[model samples]
Target: MPRVEFGMKTESGEEFTINGELTDDELLTITNFVQSAEKLLECRLVQCGNFLPKKITWNQVSGFDICEVNEIDFEALFACLHLSRPFILQKEPWSYNSVSGILGRVFSHHSEVKRELKGLRKIYSDGALSYYFDISIQEKSIFDESRFLSWLNSYQYHRDQDKSVLYDELKSSFSENGAHHIMLIRLHGKLQAIEQLTHLCKVIIKSSAKQS
Candidate 1:
């Protein structure tokens, strides 16, 4: 293997220089970046968290969990997807809601998060979040068991004394906010891979300089 010097200059007049071969410290930085990225990539909210070593079936396919979802949480989840397509989540233009714009689907000034997105269903005609973000419910989801029970508690669904009574309090307190859509999954527990990985790439860039 050969080693050489690397160098570059940004349009902002910032310049960077490095060696073609990774130093011991640089190797550790790259290892951290790669491992962190791999962990984030493996962080999937599945229909089943644990599974047997046998082939699994698709029966568990159900709608989508835990901490109150926030703005950065969405960003972390979105970055993990490495979306090949553009997905600018916004209030439907047809929606007469007083508010408008990207991420407006999640937050609201005039009302609660749920109310801001009330009556949003994913039917063919309905331009719900599903209309724009059409991933499989099994592969990814925006609903959870708590909401399911809430729906069951509603007269519209069912409220069996054995099943619905116990969770009634939880149901009442569980805000119908759509935060559970992506759940509260922080990538590698708040590891910012884009910035760190971009840094590692800089450290690992092959040098064009010839060895002396």
Candidate 2:
């Protein structure tokens, strides 16, 4: 039988290499396992890499390998797998707000975001990180900077006022780190929310200039 090799990190923060033949049974097992884990963790299965027979045929698979089958919940795992398969197969544009919604749900469910926020809070209690905005631009323009700064300032002001609506406005008007963050989590994929954000910024700048 031809063999394939891949690597994965377990929940315990341990790294292990997986080597085996690619068979329908193995595929189904992996799919089932990933599905269960996703339900327990409320996330999605993202393919990290593929193994072909050519790469592993000659070399002995050797490393600090540890193997164990930790207990798993089968039902929840399959549910998450089912929810995620369609999204994985389709190529669709993800909006900033929609991405944010997905992430909010994940963070609330997983507590990983909460843990990170706690670490950040220990360093900066006043939420100074809120002031930092990442703006991606293809071409530098004074008008673009002005509009972006204005939008950012407006967002900050509303945030300070405890306005719930500002979250949507800011996410829609400016790119969201959370959206990009979640895409990385859910699909193990990179999202061009920054590109979409820059495009929106340019449109806003052009429209503002036309009005003047």
Candidate 3:
């Protein structure tokens, strides 16, 4: 049987061995093993050596040996998510703590919304990066019709007469120490724009999860 050997380093700086066979079934098994270990140890496993899939011994197995694990820093990971690209594409680590916090705030009432708004303002005030969501659509519907018109009106009111108004609005809206806002703006003035927005958000979130 074709055999493979891979090396990885745990978050705690422990090196380990991972061996498997060069087959689809074996690859899936190896990935599952690594994921399980990551969950159990509460740490990420990074590949330490190139994937070598042609050299294996009968005694080798498709799993890690001497796996080392370490604690995770979720806060730092979350902060990093907003620093580089759109929120969805940012490579940030995800942990139960961070996920819980996000869910709590998102599902909270108006009071929580206000609190988050304030927090966003603070983030912007601290000169954090911001993202503007632009939408595009192939077809239109009632929702798109209404939201797009509203956004257009708002944009015109803020920018048509003077560009400075737009800048002023951005500054005012994103004010407060540590307050950062991800602005969702109508791009093609269509509700179908949501499709693109959704796609972008997914991409960012997925990337962040993997990297974190």
Candidate 4:
């Protein structure tokens, strides 16, 4: 059997590598683990170079690496694999006036968003990391400086009004034709950039599925 190599991190932060054939049983185990809410919090993929596509490193001083995924094709594939509605994960609190955690449950089952969640295991386990999607997070999110405060104020205002119906609509535009979501994650007490948020969204989707 042909062998494939991959890496992963556990809840204890220890790392290990696996070298074996990509069998169906392994694939099913990985997918099920990633989609489990309990496991989604800490497990992560590591040493994923073998699963991603090949890239040439620039020898010159001005060289850089490139890995890109087409949004249209990715969304199409995502919809094809999914049978549920997409949601938004708000990092900041919605309103101090209402009961805590209620809004979060109303919006997403989990209030926190993480990059190296279990759902991402598939990217490395199935070779989608290199060919289908990128698994990196922006060091500095643009939302940290721009658009976050404004969005936060709007969210607070809607929530303060005690209009759960209006707040839900403001949270996610549930249009049938809508393709994807632009999520805002507030890390270090602020919203980070919008880039690569798709990865977090994917993790949340998988984790949430486990709940339902």
Cα lDDT tens digits, model 2, 1-212, are 22334344557897765333333443333334334333323332222121111111112454111122222333433444345432222232232233233333333533543353344332221212223322332332212222322322344222333333333333443245432221122222111222222232233233334433
The digit string of per-residue lDDT tens for model 1 on 1-212 reads: 33435454555787655343434444343344444445443544221222111221122343222233333433444444332011111232211121112113322332432332343222211222333443233332323333333333442224455554323433333333332222222112122323333343433433312452
Write down the RMSD of candidate 4 (Cα, Å).
16.8
Model 3, TM vs. native: 0.15
Ranking according to TM-score, highest score first: 1, 4, 2, 3
Q: By TM-score, how accurate is candidate 4? A: 0.19
Ranked by TM-score, the better of candidates 2 and 3 is 2
Per-model TM-score, in order, reads 0.24, 0.18, 0.15, 0.19
Residue-wise lDDT of candidate 3 within 1-212, one digit each (tens)? 23434344555887764332233343333333334323332322112111112221222353211112223233432332222112222132322222223423432543433353444432322212213222222232212323322333344223343333333343343341101111221221111222222332233333334433
Best by TM-score: 1
lDDT of 1 at 120: 26
**Residue range 139-211, candidate 4, lDDT tens digits:** 4222222222333333432333343332234233322111012111122111111112233333333443443
Which structure among the candidates has the greatest lDDT?
1
**Candidates 1 and 3 compared by TM-score, better number:** 1
Model 1 residue pairs with clashes: 64-143, 142-181
